[model samples]
Target: MFATVAFAQANDDLTINTPPSIVQCKTTMISWDGGVSPFDLVRISISLSMHNTETPNLLLSINLRAKCSVTEEGVVVEDFPNILPGSSFDFFVDFPAGATLGFTVTDNNGDKAETAPVTVQESDESTCLSD
Candidate 1:
C-alpha cells in the first residue's frame, strides 16, 4: 500500500513586529519586513480589537484599510512617509486602561500576520480615551 502526504508552503520573506504593550489612546508603532519588489502597490488591511484581560473575552473590534507604495528600500506608509522596511507603522486605539489589545496585518496577496493580546496602559492627562 502507498500513502500520500501533503505539505504547506510558507512565505519566509515577510516579517512583522508589534508592541508588547501600548498606552491607551496613544499612537503605537507596528512594523514589518519587506520583500516585495519596488514600484508595487500593496493593499494593507488592519484590524484593532480590545478584550477584557482578566476574562479573555472580546469587547470591541475595528477594521481599517490603507494603500502603501513599495520602493527599492521598502513600503512607504502614508502615516509615516519616511519610514523604511522594519521601521514602523503607527496605530491608535481608544481602549480603556488594562484592556487587552490585539491587531492583524494583511497584504493584497493574502500574506498576513497577527499578534497576541497586549496590555493597554493608562493614558496621560493630555490623551483622550476616545474621539
Candidate 2:
C-alpha cells in the first residue's frame, strides 16, 4: 500500500524489523535485516512486480522530477526519467510522467539495489522548479 505492511518472515525466523528501506529524495531511510538483502526484498520484489504506470504503482510513486540526494551525484530524476548510472549508497524508485517506470539503480559493485516503497504527493507548491 502507500505505507508499511507485514511481509512473510525469512527462513531465519526473524520477522523483518524496521520496515522496508525507503529512499525518498531528502527523506531517505535504508536498512537491512532478517538475512534478506534489501535488494532482494525491495528491488527484486517490487521492481519486477510493477506492470505499468496506469497500474497502481508501488512505493516511490509520486515525484515526476524529484531529487533525493543520497550522495553528491544524488538521485536526479526528470519527467523523462533520465537516470544516470553510478555506485551509490542506495536508490529510489521513481515514476516519471510518461513511459514505464523501473528501478535501475546499482550499488558500489555496480550491482542492483533494494529499496522500500514510498508514496510522494505534495499538496504544496514546489520551490525547486521554476516556470
Candidate 1 lDDT tens digits, 55-94: 3432333223433232221122222232333335676645
lDDT, candidate 2, equals: 0.30
lDDT of 2 by residue, 1-131 (tens): 42333334322231222333332232333333332333222222222122343333332322334543222111323232222331222344332222222233322233443333334323233343222
Badly placed stretches (over 4 Å) of model 2 are 1-14, 17-24, 36-39, 44-89, 93-118, 121-131
Q: What is the lDDT, from 0 to 100, of the residue 119 in candidate 1?
A: 67
Q: Give candidate 1's TM-score.
A: 0.51
Clashing pairs in 2: 21-116, 25-68, 39-114, 59-118, 60-118
